[model samples]
Target: MIKVLIVDDSALIRSLLKEIISKEPDMMVVGTAPDAYAARDMVNRFTPDVITLDIEMPKVDGITFLDKLMKARPTPVLMISTLTAKGADATLKCLELGAIDYIEKPKIGVTEGIEAYRQIILEKVRTAAVSKVARRTSTPATVKQQSIISGTEKIIAVGASTGGTEAIKAFLLALPANAPAVVITQHMPPGFTRSFAERLNNLCKVNVSEAKGGERLLPGYVYIAPGDIHLGIEKSGADYRTVLIDGDRVSGHKPSVDVLFQTVSKTAGKNAIGIIMTGMGKDGAAGLYDMRQSGAYTIAQDESSCVVFGMPGEAIKLGAAMTVCHLDNIAKTVFDYLNVTGSGSRL
Candidate 1:
């Protein structure tokens, strides 16, 4: 059975979480603690496989405790935080610090929302239990934009989930400001994606922003899909523009990777590149295959570089990925493919 420890400052949250988690047959609640000291002792005693951590703890903040825990124990952690802007920023930082995933606590109907989201919370914990937890690593300095042939004919359609925030950052960080127009759909909430895009814009040479739809896909610019909407592309004469599709969840996710890839397949055909990064489940496997069939080059992150290889692994098995490589080499590989195919000028 998967062992879990609940660390929260609120008794209501702790009790609610314990009740929800204990209902799962494959996982069990080992213990619950209201503070860092109590949590530290429980962690040593139980050595739980997964931890549900609350960010707004008193005395010792969740981030500081997380940093220490990751360094000393390296156990898989799932953060429970509010979904406000401040919470989004802290949760993103926690992901960078090696927390596998997070769940947003409700702002208004605390009991109702938490109870309603029990399945999702349990799923995150399950993903965390099986996920690989690594100690903190230093961030790479942003690479400067180098001049390359400028045009928007070629588009890059990227999709990721789970560990995607950092993977997308690494991929975009390595690209020059003059790289091809790129679009991404990461499985995240509305507020979080805006923050994620802003963070990338500050660090990378490329201009990154949340998609407003109808804007021309321009070279040196990146667009991120807003949460709760599907982001697709449409051909506008010789150029492509972003379009947001309002619909129910596809592939069990709003802003599904498959929706984006399918649009790229039909609109850009051989002129596009499809990248399926680290995420859980098969959200993008079939869509990646569709892109390949449409003559778009497709790539997947190799298992060694993926925190959870479910998505890419499924794609690899289905022959959707034309090339598989480590996360560190994806940008180089994309450039190499483009250069050989004469799609764009290289640096």
Candidate 2:
């Protein structure tokens, strides 16, 4: 059985979480704490398999506590955040600090909202329980000089989920500022995407920002699909532009990687490079295959480097990927492809 620890200042939220977790036959609530100090004590006593952390609390904020917890005793943590931009930013910070995943708290009808999202909450907990807990010690993606923009006219398409935040970060950080025009879809909620893009922009040499429809895709810039929207690319004269559409969930997610990949296959064709990274489903497999058929170079993150080898594994199994490499090497691989003329294999 999965043992869980709930750490929140709200007694109501704690009680509600306990109720939901207890109902799962394969899970049990080991303990609950109202603050970081109490949560630390409970950690020693219960040794839970998973933890649900609230972003705001008295005496200590969730981010600081999470930093300490990961350094002292790394464990899988699922953040409980409000559905506001601030909450979204903090949740992203927690993920960067080593939290496994997060669940957004509702702005209204707390009890009913929790009940409505019970299945998702439970599923996230289960995913977290099996997730890796490594302290990320990579230096920040800080560059002093303006990155030299390569004049190569190529389009880069990336998709990720679950542990994609860090994977995406690593990929983007390694990229030279003027590498290529990049479009990405990372599974996330609506309010969170903007903050995530902003965070990446501050760190990476590339100009990363949330995509707004109709912007011309340009080299050195990365367009991240906004939450609750599907992002696609279309040819405009000699250039391509970003497209955001509202639609039903495809492959069980909004801003799906499949949507972006399929569009890239049709629009950019041979000029595009598709990379599917760590995620939890087959959302991008067929699209990646379509890309390969269109003569675009396709790459998948290797199993050893994936936080969860689900999405990329699916793509490789479908023969969608022409090359498979570790996350650390993806940026270099893309550069290698751009540097070579044609008919090249994995780097």
Candidate 3:
């Protein structure tokens, strides 16, 4: 059974979360607390498998407490965050501080969407229970071995979920400033993708921003698919441009990785590089296989470096990846793949 603890200032939120978690046959709510102080006591007594931590509380905010918990005990934590710009930034901080994942906190007195909210909460809790927790740390800095890929026409399609916010950041940090055009699809909601792109832009050498369809794909820039719309690429005379596709959810998600990967296969063919990163579920497996079948070079993150290993593992099982790399060496792998001649190869 999975043991859970709920920490929040609001009595209602604590109660609601408990109600949702308690219904699961394999989960038990070990305790509930109104602040970090009480939560610390419960952590000692219950030693729960997962914690649902509220971002905003009366004292000792979520970020500070999360840092403390990671340093002291290192239990898996799932942040309960609002779907606001400030909340997005704070939630990312919690992830950096070692929280396994986050769930959107429901509005006060929420009624109409209670069922959906319960489902999401339980799913996140389940994920958190099995997640690995460790001290706050940065991805190892691996210097770029060379300058840049030879052509602006080469394309990269990256897909991730779960721990991807950091995985994507680590991968992007390795690419050269003038590397090939990259189109990314990460599982996020409507309000967070713009902020996530902005966050990556500030840290990496490459220009990163949310895709606003019709923008021409170019080297030195990375475009992230907007939260709800699937991102695709198509020819615009001689150059390629972003396209916001409207369709039913593919592989259990909007802005699905499968859509982006398959789209790249159809449009760029062998000129594309497909990367399946750390994530939950099998969203990108079939599409990644399609890319490999179409002669595009494909890579999957190795298990030791993955937060979940589900997505990349699926792709590997399907015989999709041409190369399997650790997260730190992915950019180096890309550099080795795209030699100076501009025709791709693998090391």
Candidate number that wins on TM-score, 1 or 2: 1
TM-score of candidate 1 versus the correct structure, residues matched by position: 0.94
Best by TM-score: 3
lDDT minimum window of 10 residues, candidate 3 = 338-347
- Per-residue CA lDDT of model 2 for 246-312, tens digit only, reads 9998999898999999999999899899999988878999999999999999999998888778899
- Model 1, 26-64: lDDT tens digits are 989999999999999999999999999999999998999
Tell me each candidate's TM-score.
0.94, 0.92, 0.95
The parts of candidate 3 lying over 4 Å away from their true place are 142-149, 340-347
Q: lDDT of each prediction vs. the true structure?
A: 0.88, 0.87, 0.87
Better of 2 and 3 by TM-score: 3
Worst 10 residues of 2 by lDDT: 140-149
Off by over 4 Å in 2: 106-116, 140-152, 342-347
Q: Which predicted model would earn the best lDDT?
A: 1
* Model 1 poorest ten-residue lDDT run: 139-148
Candidate 3 per-residue lDDT, tens place, 1-347, comes to: 99999999999999888888898899999999999999999999999999999999887998999988888899889999988889988998888787888999888776998888888888878877765663445755644546444465789999998888888988888777778889999999886899999999998888999999999888879999998899989988877899999899999999999999998999988889999998889999999999999989999999888777889999999999999998888888887877653654221
Error of 1 at 12 (Å): 0.6
Model 1: pairs clashing at backbone N, Cα or C within 3 Å: none
